[model samples]
Target: MTADPIDQALFPPFDDAAGFDRIRADLGAFLPAIRAVCERHGLAASGLAAFERGTNVVVSNDAGQIIKLFPPFLRHQFEAERLALGRVHGNVPVATPEILREGELDGWPYLVMSRLPGRTLEEVWPALGGAERAEALARIGEIMTAAHALPTGGLESLDLGWDAFVERQIAGCEGRHRRMRLPERLIAQIPAYLASARPLLPTSVIPVLLTGEYTPENLLVTQTGGAWRVTGMIDFADACLGPAEYDLLGPCLFLAAGSAELQRAFLVACGTGIADADLTPALSRKLMALALLHRYSNLGYQVRIEGWESQASSLSALEQLIWPFPVR
Candidate 1:
């Protein structure tokens, strides 16, 4: 059986980063074909802008809808995202995009979702006062706590059970950091550190749906009553079933940016207690290990961490700098 021309045209091998860049640079070449697909499904394609942060072809249409098209290799992401949005609908306090339509177009899976309200949290973070930033972080913490409290019934469909996922990540922990060109000294210690910490890791717990990327970019905030509040939580493409701590990596490393006050507010809001002593060094180490093992934990891709170069001498130092727990 021959593949359809549209499928053949839209599909690109995942290994070719340059090829993906070329497609993004000249999105016009693919717009006509994408427009045809959207029109066939009764979605207007005008006002399309390629969402630059992601690897896939994601664009927002004039109708206040986001249409994300995934190549064959990334079809799992489409399925995971669709299932996540559906399962979390009406279950949490924050607004989540409603899946309007989902189907395969020329072998490329696409999902049309309602465009969420408010600007992304990252857009407003730099302009906020200390009080506003703290309030926003607390609100985010609350939202995350509520999200993690939801039942994980339908999430198993993603086939990423917690124990298996952790084991897999642990096995590849060293190699992944090595490939990311981590310093030789730190890379050498990763294996022993991870092995020693394996027993400390959670093997069994009530699994919660993990929004693997809980950074500011995925959180939408709006100013109301003279305070910043999280209005919506978007982008669950990397959602998985895992321990609650996994969700905190982004907020700690990226959003809070080593702010003790913000981290305290976040923890207090999450009902994890306000004392710095609450975040024990061992627990901090485990969470730090998980952060390093995160699927997208490549320093080359995370420009935000570049600012900490002077403070971080090794992986351990970097972890301590990003998530400083009081020394006993």
Candidate 2:
């Protein structure tokens, strides 16, 4: 409708950029623009390289820092991340990014933060042994536990009220899943299943900050005496405030890969014990509803376990399959 203002020689031709495909398709093209932000901030000599993962424009260098950019339409994520990193930095067990500088570039907001060490758990999960995986999940649980315990009295930016958020998600649950091409079997059960699970969810529980970013993608791991450990956590752009269980969906469905032992370890360490009489089944049901309601939920893509589709004949079946746990 109007003229593009960014220097074409530097920034990608992001005109009418509706989806991430354009960015992902030619990520290198945006490096000049990425560097322009650095140049503006006087950190341009650090030699940049693009990280080819996830949505968003990201680049890092050997200067012990990284830069992340959120498109104009996604500026809310930039604000959310900036606030989240500050709130949980020293409070959580694992290391989180420390913001060094932040500013907007031609309508795209960017943050230059202290880069954390260790490979991402997503990069190493497939190779880790049983014990290492267990330990990693356990550590993740601890980080989450500490986060949930932090005071949430006045952080309105992070508090995505669980009630209203869920209401909206429920309203569009069927349509969202349908658009995502979820199987008709699961799609058909959305209404009654969520209604049945409503009694299991909390209406008055103390709200906690929810990052929804604890998956292998965000978790960093390093070896400690031959065992992998979750050393750092990143990507807080999707952070919000909500019921604690809502945060667990990422770890349970993504990193645990539907394993009873690993999922139970994570849930237990997260302070929601999976043992009998500890509300595992009820909690599992609650999380299932959350899995559908998550802002970025795409079950078919996020859940990593093989054969899950075959096992998930219904919503209840899916919950049990992913959260069998120490319930037995």
Candidate 3:
């Protein structure tokens, strides 16, 4: 039997120290061969630039299509993204890439998807004023609410069930933070804090599909009638079935950035009334603990939180640091 060409290509584990650098190098070396595969499938590569910002080797062309290639070791991400994009298409207001084709090329799994039109929110956020940012954040909140309301039937087959997933995170909370080099004071409080807050974790609310990273980078924005609005949501590789609050961590921590007004606008749009007391100290602590336990949580990569180090003396202080009350 002949070996698959993709199988013959050397690829590192997902967590290899060199990570995407190694993948990019290998992909560059194999570009001619990859381009041949695309040509065979009627996707022309002339004058097209490949976008390598993410872990995968992705290319888009004038034909309004995105071609994403995943190494065999990262096939799970391919499957998750393909399934998520298909499931969420047309069901939510915000646009999502539609899967046009999916298969393996020389052992590398690939998905060809329709291109979504809009600029990433991160690109436009800095120019917007406070009111404009708030409006966009509130619209994002509404989009998230709609996404969470979608049925989870298609995602049930994913490897980790919600309860077991939370349990795993709970068990690893302390060690995970330690590896991320979280402050010693915060690290020491994790175990007992999580133990006391376990009951408050979203076991009671009906589980919903969480697009784990809702930060500006994953959102697309465009001006509609002179107002900036979120037009599309992308990158479902981290999607999972979890509590809605767990999904809010990205927007709250990254987008709102302790702005009480922005946070209120977001929560109000999500239909969670904006009482200052709603995010009580206990609830805030629980959410912060859960933030640390999030699937992709790592303070090492979240350089924004470094600014709070001087103020995070206690849990209450940490909450204030991450989600301060609005100024009068």
Q: What is the C-alpha lDDT of each candidate?
A: 0.74, 0.80, 0.73
In model 1, where do residues sit more than 4 Å from their true spots?
1-18, 271-277, 300-307
Model 3's alpha-carbon lDDT is: 0.73
User: Model 2, clash count?
Assistant: 1
- Where model 3 places Cα greater than 4 Å from the true spot, the runs are 1-17, 25-27, 271-277, 303-306, 325-328
Candidate 2 on 152-203: residue-level lDDT in tens? 6666877777778778889999999998888999999999999998887767
Check candidate 2 and list the clashing pairs. 160-241
lDDT of model 1 at residue 7? 46
The predicted structure with the larger lDDT, 1 or 2, is 2
* Residues 1-328, model 1: lDDT tens digits: 1124564554444456557666753466568656756776788878887777776787887889988777767777887898788878788888999988877767777887899889988898888999888887888788787778877776787645678778788788779988888767777788777877677777776677877656888889877887778889888888877777777778877777666666676766773333556766676677678776777877544525556756676767776776666533
Over 4 Å off in model 2, which ranges? Answer: 1-10, 15-18, 24-27, 272-276
Q: What is candidate 3's lDDT per residue for 1-328, written digit by digit as tens?
A: 1124454443334465356556653545556645755665787676556775666777777788877777666777887887777778898878989887777766678787888889888889888899999988888888888888888786775435667888898888888888888888988887777777777676645678777657888898888888788888878877767677777788878778767777777766774443555755555666676777787777545525556877678655776777665434
* lDDT measured at residue 283 in model 3 versus the true structure, 0 to 100: 57
Model 1 has how many clashing residue pairs? 0
For TM-score, the strongest prediction is: 2
